[model samples]
Target: MISMFDSDVVSAELLADIVSVSKATLLKWEKSGRLIPSQNSITHRKEYKVSQLIQFEEVRNMINSNWDQELNVKPAKDFSSVELFAGAGGLALGLEKAGFNAVALNELDEDACKTLQGNHSQWNVIQGDVKNVDFAKFIDVDLVSGGFPCQAFSYAGEKLGFEDTRGTLFFEFSRAVKEIRPKVFLGENVRGLLNHDNGKTLSVIKSIISDLGYTLIEPKVLKALFYRVPQKRERLFFVGIRNDLVKFAKFQWPSPYYRILVLKDALKAGELYATDVPKSEGQSYPNRKREILSYIPQGGYWRDLPDDLQREYMQGSYFLSGGKTGMARRLSWDEPSLTLTCSPAQKQTERCHPEETRPLTIREYARIQTFPDEWHFSGSVSSQYKQIGNAVPVNLAYAVGRSIIALLNSIDAEVDLGSDSLAFNGSFHSRQLTLLNT
Candidate 1:
């Protein structure tokens, strides 16, 4: 047998660098059985076969060709949607651009509601907890969407169904879906939710979605970099079509853009934006932080710091085994920006500007999220950061939104042809016999 830890086994870091993706992307690949890893005897760290690296590189190149395909994304007819937890309108705005009309937007955050109202005075910005609202009044809606926060559920000897999640926000999202009975629904969350509670949580979510009479598509965590957004944020998106509409609609995910975008495309006048980022308020680094970060070269991290400074900055973490890649990290203009954090200057997640040593300004953060320069965030600076950081990148949402539109169009056309039709999700289409009954 070949040696498990031979030179052919490559650490994930080397493979990520070789393919120009993040370590997080590599982890996802490992879980999906794309890049199988074996333990290195000397380091006991994850390593992959050299052949795997070449395979991934070829796939990456093929994705670049997909950017040229024209998407027939126009809304087939006037479609309306209701959005829950509409923070600063990132997802809502993107869906609107993809041609869904926003009927009403509900958000508990006062600042977020104000931001929505400020941006669109005519919008019905409902400011209150989602639990108190009744969604049935919003009839004839084609879609219901929300980026619900992920919370671990308490499994106390009960079946994980719609009622089991009563205490959590997901229950509220499900309730809205049940009451409104939209043709389709969308739910977005952090990528970690996929493996949360050893994947039991996601399994339960799918069950509840089925219990509510919708066919939940196999969930996917989409990397923002694969879209037009110049950031590496990843979001887990679930698209569920009503059982009645599934046979008529075949959902296809939005294709990746022709090219990967970089931080320069976000900050400067480029294909993504018509003008350079505007000057805006931003957080400042303390004197001590400024001194430490000044030494970090663009795209470099704490390892670049002197030994003493690294010890002081990382505290006891310096002795830790894992690669603390984000510590004192400075972004490079040529690469996609790392995922934005709720705060730009946290010691562990310092996103220093490529040219400037300071943290990126608010405008830059918005730009990285593919938020238009003119979109104003209403709140304290920190709150503004939180809203943007928590949002789905506008361009990524737009791409997915277009895919949903296409599915809806197909469903509409099929309905016109035959009153009783069926649709399926991704490639996990249910058997024709069971699909009709469901």
Candidate 2:
């Protein structure tokens, strides 16, 4: 096995993709001498040795974790959650493990709804758009959660109101929370949402959330890597408390896992898994893509291609300044995976397996997201990928769920002294409660 310390060279496009930065930013870094670019003799294109990234504090921490300690925290109270945009139940399943019984799960995609229903027939999987659902049915649910799509709003008026965001899915999320009036609400979105539109969009979201009678805690972008998932995906989380409950609503975000998980831990029988990843249907690359990817090494991308092939594969993008690292990329077993996109073998964001030259299989994809082996996905292979790729990593959601449960437990005991609460080990706790099992 090649050590992660082995000097890695990648194109500007790949580095940009890795850090979610722009090529213009790379140039800015270069100008500031924060980044030094090297030329690939063949393409004469600039590449950067990954030595700087390797020595980076965060990267170093990722590669050198014990990852040996396992934490499966349980809930402090038997809370119920109503999930919107519940894709294939990744977040739902993890939250269930943390002890939130899902009373209802609403999804727009039929395949994703079936995937949820197929796995857990008892779940009330409501199929169709968020706009159609009457969330009033789930009244007084402990929590309402969803990974709503982000949309830009018109700032035509001086202030953005809850109604101003009417056309966007986020508006639907806010609407559901308004109707259900849950004690707590969790909204998830892509990390880009944190800074979308010069921060105006997030500011508007915060304003709308506040206007809806909830106290919006400052949103945080949680990195999946820190939460025991073997991937580098980032999701922005917004936790809000019902206005009346804000004083006592102490919501602590979940703690990071003991160590970072890697692809090996995910796919093999190790810390994150009890058995090898099960074989299943998957997307395959065409002969040309397969042939092209064969030349790349584990953790390598298009820059690893031969000069002519680099030009051939990249074409016009070859001349483009960005590294486009997702193209013809293969993951390294020793490190956490780059985020999995909807289409694994798509031209711009391929997720080829480490040892094999094809895209990751369905089960492999699930494992990387920390889904249990017995959990079955129902849909065409492509639809399955869409479900899994778009999901919050199971382990990440579990960590968040645990924290939410802790907060709810505290409130239950404080507000109603007779309430039964869950102990750290899943048993009952006392009225004066300690939050996390920390």
Candidate 3:
């Protein structure tokens, strides 16, 4: 990713943003010798010299990013893709921006289908359970993509293959690939899958990818914050090439954008949005809850409330272990928003406005997800929130989409595999792509 990281020094805040971690985690890395800042600034703040930080993988990638060149890339021909589990069109729209045309989109939710149809009348959206849909008709589509829900397999003390994963959403996705036989396919899911079932789940998935006659790229979670998205959302992406094309195709993960966007960019008129977030329907707390939340400051949570209020608000959760940082939480304008959930005001994941004492409005949620203001939703307020919250940030998808396009371009031009042109990751400012979701 071509980001603007020209300075010789990197601040603690900037480094933390680039690495997709908290400042405290940086401190922990320092203590463990995993990361060490070269020196402090004139104001006595921790600062890292970029030259000395190249020992880190993320830093090295950033310093050698080629995001600007990637952005200028275009399709060698009209490329088409079939998207499964196309929730609310976030991924489809992003891929559209990155130069892929949607041949067909499959969605199970009627509302999400309508959202996609209303926004893009030209799209062929098929609404129904994917089990009933056949992909054999859409042949040679170039690419197939899906954000399939992560489900564990029934392990039998043996390695699993394609049929072993029957009855799961992932199987349906694999079935699509089996039928369409696209040159490439992309799968996305929560980062937690990296360790689900103690890593056996991922192991089985690897087996299935191989069984499907594709070569799986080493998957990585890309952080939205580094992709010009103003929310701390992350999604794990898996890109694979058809076995026949594996010898010729080179797939590189997208590099990170230079800057980290925060809540202020999402809600106010700035780089991310052309205007302040438009007022709309949103969830509200009862009088007592609002009163209690008002006591919390921007970036503070229930712990910041008075002791009595904390007991009243947290109830049994108060006695629970772990930080429970999401409780009674108020967002900070200067920082990216906490990962949003299906509902904005759940007791376990309270995301109050940075200044206002209310949950984020539907429009605000869309803004944080980097959905354009004009891309209207087609559901009740609650459904809209769920759709927006569940979406891949449009910008994040766009960034990855660019990299996918680059890979396709390389394959089409029959570019030399020995050249850096097929790098898994090109030069960046040493502070680029790894998305995280909560």
Candidate 4:
């Protein structure tokens, strides 16, 4: 049983047990000003008060809650979206901001589905494998969007079709688009997809979309930092229009925000928030690792450490050729953080705090990904971290959502104007020049 004491001072070990954190992390929090110790009225020794712990419920509850923040801004237009492979609710929330209602969302992870439902009970979340669900039942969606994993297709013939691309997640995603036949579709993936299988993978994807009677746009990679997310994330975007309507409308991607946001904007009450990041459950480094990282300066990496510590931290990889940028790295408050991974403390891609020697907490991870403060996550500490890291940054998804809305609006306008006015043939360039000159 836990004891509730009043005005009594407790040691770091006691605080660690109460908060379920390590002593090293509690010490680091003290140094970073996140958690300060109170002086005992009589003893004059540093100790944490029980009242202080109770005041941080926002952080404590985050261990098992999903975030749900209302959008403060107004929407430019109204549209509807059908999302596939929805993980956590980053993309869904973003699309909501662009004035689109999520008619349906499909996700395989049960916890992620719970997170989505916990926040937005009205959302139609299909919790199962995409292969088991039939997308044909969902009709009249203005747009179909997903961040499908990139997979290499077996090239048995010159062209890949829906039947030839079996046993791959991409096949399921494409089949949904073919069945629903929405006015427009959007697909996203890691930037490496551009060069996967020597570019054959992307080529096959384009061919499949074309065969489904859609006009594929030249895919481009969008940098998240440019779109108001405080992370240097890059994702490949592929947009397509139903071929019948392609000649009638043109689409443009969203423009970058005026300024790039940094870590300070994400975690604290500044440009991106109204208050400091709430305290929450977080992972901690071992004693030895914590002491070694203490010497690393903000915005510095392994090179900033002493000669011996550098080689020790890097191990045999120290002699390797690549930049090894993530090793022993500390983030800078003024710059976007590196792309987050499933595990915050992994040696290969450490996302240490800007001012502390520890990794970012669960709440900090959510904030950097643009999740609202109220959104709660369920599961163990490690599982929560994995869900947050795997999600798309909400702001980045909102930017893409705005572009989808614009395209849908154009399609609606074209349809209202009648087919004759929007018709385009081989003489499109000459006709456009004539209209401009006239």
* Residue clash pairs of candidate 1: 67-258, 246-422, 246-423, 247-422, 247-423, 248-422, 248-423
Give lDDT for model 3.
0.84
Alpha-carbon lDDT, every model = 0.83, 0.82, 0.84, 0.79
TM-score (all chains, Cα) for each model: 0.84, 0.81, 0.87, 0.78
Candidate 1, residues 1-438: lDDT per residue as tens digits?
A: 122212555566445644667889988988998878898786566788765655664334433434445355688899899999999899998899899999999999999898999988988999999999999898659999999988877663136468888879998899999888998998999999999999878878888898899999899888887788888788899999998888799887777764567899999997888988999999999999899889988678999999999999999998999988888999987678999999998887888999888999999999999998889999899999988988889999888888888888898888666533434343333454455444
Pairs that collide, model 4:
59-279, 65-376, 65-377, 66-375, 66-376, 67-374, 67-375, 67-376, 68-375
Ranking by lDDT: 3, 1, 2, 4
Q: After superposition, how far is residue 409 of candidate 1 from its true place, in Å?
A: 0.4
TM-score of predicted model 2?
A: 0.81
- The candidate, 1 or 4, that scores higher on lDDT is 1
In model 3, what lDDT does residue 311 have? Answer: 96
Expressed as tens digits, the lDDT of each residue in 159-181 for candidate 2 is 84877888889889989998989
Best by TM-score: 3
Return the candidate ranking by TM-score, descending: 3, 1, 2, 4
For all candidates, the clash counts are 7, 7, 22, 9
Error of 2 at 418 (Å): 11
lDDT of 2 at 136: 91
Show model 4 residue runs off by greater than 4 Å. Answer: 1-78, 419-438
Winner on lDDT (2 vs 3): 3
